[model samples]
Target chain A: MRASIVQTSVAVVATLLLFYPVLQIVLLSLNKLPYFRLGGEFIPTLESFQWVLQQPEFWRGLLNSLVVSLTTVGILLALSLPGAYAFSRYKFKGKDALLSFYVVFTQVSGGLGIAGLIALFAIVSALGLRNNLFALALIYAAGAIPYHTWLLKTYIDTIPKSAEEAALIDGAGVNTLMLRVVLPLMAPALAVSSILSFIGAWGELILANLFLSGENRTLILWIYSLMSNVYSVQWNRFAAAALLYSIPPVVLYVVLQRFLKRGLAFVY
Target chain B: MRPQWLILPGLLLFLFFNIWPIIYSIYISFTNANIKNFPPPPPWAPEELKQARPPPDFVGFANYASILTGPASSGFLGAVFWTLIFVALSVPAKVALGTFVGLLMSSDRVVGKPIMRALLIVPWALPLIISVVAWRYVFDPTYGVVNQLLYAVGISKPPDWFVNKDYAYAAMVVIEAWLAYPFIMTVVMGALANVPRAAYEAAYIDGAGRWAVFTRITLPLIKRPLIYASVMTAAASLQFFLVAFLWNFIQLYDRFMLAYGYYWAFGSPFREYGLAAAVLTMSALLISVFMILAIRLAGLMRGMYES
Candidate 1:
């Protein structure tokens, strides 16, 4: 009983320590004087949130973020669905090598540093796609595929081969087996990947800033530029924007909470 | 039907978007491909592929040699060293803290395990830049809550976290560990469940000490998860940019790390693509070396669970 009490206290302490800073941001958004008054000034106001709402760019950025994030999720599912099935089902010779390559591939998560990306952006533009959300989504999806393919493959592995064999024996073609037979079984993993891919594209700053500009700015790029702006950077506005910017991801987390627990239970 | 065909779309995407970019990035490192040299037009402005200018002159290893021995040499070295230090500090600390928390969660005594698990994901799930920006405010010197709290505790004359090197380093690492530890904790928690309760009971029946049981049985069982967490965290830390980018905005350039070094090359009015690419190429090489060493040391590749 004493040990249990101690463990419970530890859990509470960990949660408090983790959430306190986030709490401060939420509070700072409510309070007007973030800089002038450091002590607990609980005077709540929505001026900053209102101010962010007034800015046309914030909404535009949100829309662009949604577009890019959804695009990335679409592309990732399109590619990883088939790729994962092949890895999980096929009896290929070089399967282990390919999987190993994908494992090492996750480490290159930086996705060509912003500087290198700038150079590549030049080429991408030359190919007649510049500051395009779809173009940026392509890059985002490409970056996500290697790790996610490996991830979804592990999920696919958990489903017994008997189902696939049974489907094949029913005279279903490979495409039908993948689409009709296997995809239904992958619903939970697909949700997990969708949430992850969406979250990644939404939060990504370096590539968004490096690739998209002007009208195509993602929410993070807008938030970053707002903070970096020298003339006028209100802490209240910064706090408000950051909090609002985090909503899609937090909502996704809450909505897909169940899938993530099972999907992430074991990652290979 | 050829099984290989299913992989072709994924392969083409990887080749075109992933492999081609790296190859071209390396090629650009050899040449002077800065915007000043080959400026792109405004986004709204349309430009045809036929109108795009020819590539710049290849300067061979000049960029690499310059970054190694130029006026920017020491700054680059500082960044690399700090990157290594940040990784070295943050990864191990996170794993340790994560193991403790995971073990805590694994205990039957811990109540509301599901709620704790869900709450822990907040740090990881919240957008990273938001978290960094929030921390930036938290570390503010004058009206910052951190300073206020420190002074209230009678530690007057608290260090300005952003300006002070040691404080900034500590602050950055702590924030990273805070964000990262939960991930390791989750992975460890999952791994812990895999360790059969019977195994522990067996050890207990044998009258083994707590430390002996953990060291001999628990450690071996969770080795794969530990290695996975270590490699992922190390690689992420080595390419650490977002926090550094925001933190260094107010701080000096020397305190910056490798990723920012790459950014600085391009951030300046006179864009230096070759030099920036040199820094990038080096950063990628550094991260790859770290990942390879980690895999070699921990045998992480052996942990890949497949059908």
Candidate 2:
């Protein structure tokens, strides 16, 4: 009983320590302190939220994030499903090598080699695709494919080959087998990958900052820019904006928590 | 094999955007191609030659030489040192804390295990930028809740958290540890659940204390997962740009300047592209060496791979 009490106490302390900042932000956002002073008495006010809502940039940035995230997810699914099926079902040469490549590729830093990517972007711009959202989506999709394919392949592997074989025996075409037999079974994996891809594209700062400059800034970049200068560092407003920015990813994760767990189980 | 064609689209995309950039970055690291020096003037114009070209001249080894011996070298070295400190401190703390929580969650003594696990993941699931920003607020010396709480408890004043380098590094370490521990904890918890209980029972029957049982059985069982998590965390921490960049951008935007800043000022930020590439490539190489050493030390990979 004593040990249990100690464990409970420790867990409580750790959890509180971990979340103190978030709690503080929530409090500050709710309480409208007259001054920016840290320890001043505060009264509740909706001024921060009011300010946040009035900013057109906030809504536009959020929309851009949504568009990029959703488009990236859609493209990831369209590419990963058929690709994962082919890799899982076919005993091709260099299969192990290809698998290893994808795994290692994801493990490597996506942002590490941005300069080369910027150079390539220059080349693409020369081809007249500069500052295009579709181009950004394609870039995100390309970066996401390795991990998503690996995830889907792992999920597909768990479904017995006999299921697909039986479908084939019933005169199902390859596309039909993939569409009818494998895809449905892979829904959990698809959901998880989609969520991961969405969150990744949504929260991504460096790539977007690099590629999507000027009017094309994502929500994260916009929020980051708000705090870029001391003159613009309005704590209340930043906190409110942060709360708004954090909502979508939080909602998505909550909705897809189960699928994420399953997907994580497969990957790890 | 018609289905094989489906692989081509994804593979081609990956090759173009993913693999090609990596290769291009590696190649550029060996050159002196700075974006600032692009569109060089006619070669015959000696007067134009005197003007600092925006695109970097093909000065082989000059960039690398500068990186090692230039005035900015110490700062780069400092950044590397601090990064190492951050990783070394945070990774072990995370592993230890995570394991303790994992053990507690796995044990029957703990109540509300699901809630505990879920709470642990909240930090991990919170978007990193938001979490970091939240941490900045909490550590805000003027109006931060930390200072407020401390002052309420009779402490007269708290130190400037992000201003002083030591405190700044400490704050970063704390935030990073929080961000990372959940991942390690979840992985360790999964491994702990797979640990056979009969061994612990037998140890208890043999008059073993809790510490002895944990040290002898639990630690050894979860060794592989722990090593994997440690190495991955180490690698991730070494290349940590976001937190540092954000923190510096927030606190010392004017004061802090590096090679990247110089490039940005000149309007051809790609001047330091080669150096940036080299930095990451070296980091990857270092991580690979560490991973191989870890795998050899753990000895699990041998069994799995040999089969």
Candidate 3:
């Protein structure tokens, strides 16, 4: 089929519109000034990057973000993997009911709103878990359970049960079966799930801002604080930090792109 | 060895982290819990620190009453009104634009389909905070690309987005659509691929026009996925917070349901925890009601489990 001029033009324009904000950020990160102006002078330099790199908070925030995200992924997989395996293999009473519950729970999980936050704050404070990065990661992982379990359950359903049966017949223990047999085969799904959870924990702001403080702030939180500063914001440094912060998630999403369709299938 | 035992650990974690807060929130909403009264030091702390604060008093639905019919009602109602409007407008915009782009790019006729798709995916791929901040920049009154483009096109004095309520809301809807459309597009692209080419061929061979083919064949085929996407996006829009919160946190804090609760709980000087809990509980109830209904309407759980 011949490409229509109208369709091509519309698509091109839409692409440009979508890409402009990111392009603007890229430009702002490179621009010499701390702020942007329309038709601004275009002297580009690495000063903003240098400034961001020089800040001790930058390294701390990045490390905190990494710790939180990786721990979240670890906890998420440990919980969701076994849960998904059971859901896929077992026929328990209330199975459908529980699955339906998960469907609803995952859908409105974010709707917990301030009520969840306030109650969580109270709990975290009471337990003295405030500013604790691992506890924060646990919270992140817990929030992800229903959806990731369902997601991995769906993926597991596709894998033949014959292998597990064969392993059982060979006197393989359940632990060995899971650790050696299931885990390796489920790598792709595990990768998708972990990467998703990692990105989620990495980019999360509200909970991180509420639960963490001072030196414990995540990279996204640090960048947000810079922007939220009322009196003056160094926009160039903010843009540079934001772009740097965005790299991991963007790269992960692109990697996950191949599996996105299948993932959405499980989600809906 | 019961397979069910495997689910226990995750279930306990979910109960602790997800379910417990909600239950606690409901319990707290009925009490006059504020920053001072609640959040007493851990029981493990010394007796003096534990004795430093008294327990919260039970208010017995007073918070709900105040939010329902008292002075705080206006903010709550206004948030409800605008949240509904935002969801109503933005969900369709996102879905439609996504469908349009998905259809255009999925077609064999589109040039550089790979590049176009990659460019489109940027918004969805980038961290959401970054995207929102970049969009906040793009809508900046003085130096924003939106205004710059408006000026270049001979429309001077484009309304300052963050300064005006309507413009800010409009910018939010635009940003929401931009952030979300890629997912819808991906879903549509996936659904479209499932559509049998023979069906389209059969329609064309019968002399059906493009519009007829689309409305009759294409739409019906992708209807379920589209409905699913709409329901999910609508839920997301209903819970909309961060973009608006980031755009102009203080001014717009009371304009969305979650943000309103946020204002009461944290942003406001009073820090009315009970009242904020009441507001958020109502919001959560509304969202669950909408989601359950939509899910039921779409029969989304029909094949979710086998046994």
Considering only N, C-alpha and C atoms within 3 Å, which residue pairs clash in candidate 3? none
Give the DockQ-based CAPRI class for model 3. Answer: medium
Candidate 3: segments with Cα more than 4 A from true spot: A35-40, A259-268, B43-47, B152-156, B196-202, B303-307
lDDT by residue (A1-268, candidate 1, tens digit) is 2257777998889877777787788888888775434555677899989999998999999899999999999998899878887887887878888878887887665734443575566667667776889988988888778888888888888898888899989999877887887889888888888988898889887767767888888888889888776238788777898899999899987877666555456532
DockQ of every model listed? 0.50, 0.43, 0.65
Task: List where candidate 2 sits over 4 angstroms from the true fold.
Answer: A1-3, A34-42, A111-121, A124-128, A230-233, A260-264, B2-4, B38-56, B70-72, B146-158, B195-207, B249-271, B274-281, B284-307
lDDT of 3 by residue, A1-268 (tens): 5678878888899888778888888989999987676578867999989888998988999999999999999999999899999999999987777877876788788877355888988888888888999999999999999989988998899899999899999999989999888988888899889889998999998889888998899998888888788247678888998888888998898778776555434543
Ranking of candidates on DockQ, top first: 3, 1, 2
TM-score of decoy 3? 0.95
Best by lDDT: 3
lDDT of 2 by residue, A1-268 (tens): 2238777777777666766677777767776762344546677788888988998888888888888889999988898888888888887877778876676556554433343453464445445555667788888898889888878887787788888889989999977987888878877787788888898888887667766766677789888888675356567778788888888788877767676565346543
Across B56-145, the per-residue lDDT of candidate 1 in tens digits comes to: 678998888877888768878888887778888998888888888887788767888777777777888798888887787777786667
Residue A62 CA error for candidate 2 (Å)? 1.6
Model 2 chain B: lowest-lDDT 10 consecutive positions: B253-262
Sort order, lDDT high to low: 3, 1, 2
Off by over 4 Å in 1: A1-3, A32-39, A45-50, A111-115, A230-233, B39-54, B153-156, B195-220, B250-257
Write model 2 residue lDDT over B1-307, tens digit each, in one string.
6756878888888788777765765565566555554323345446656386544545666555655678546644555566567678888877787777777777756666677677677776677788878887777777677778888899996878887767776776777777788778877787777666677788888999989987888888777777777766765665555675677544422222222332322224345555655544444455556556655675534422221
User: Highest TM-score: which candidate?
Assistant: 3
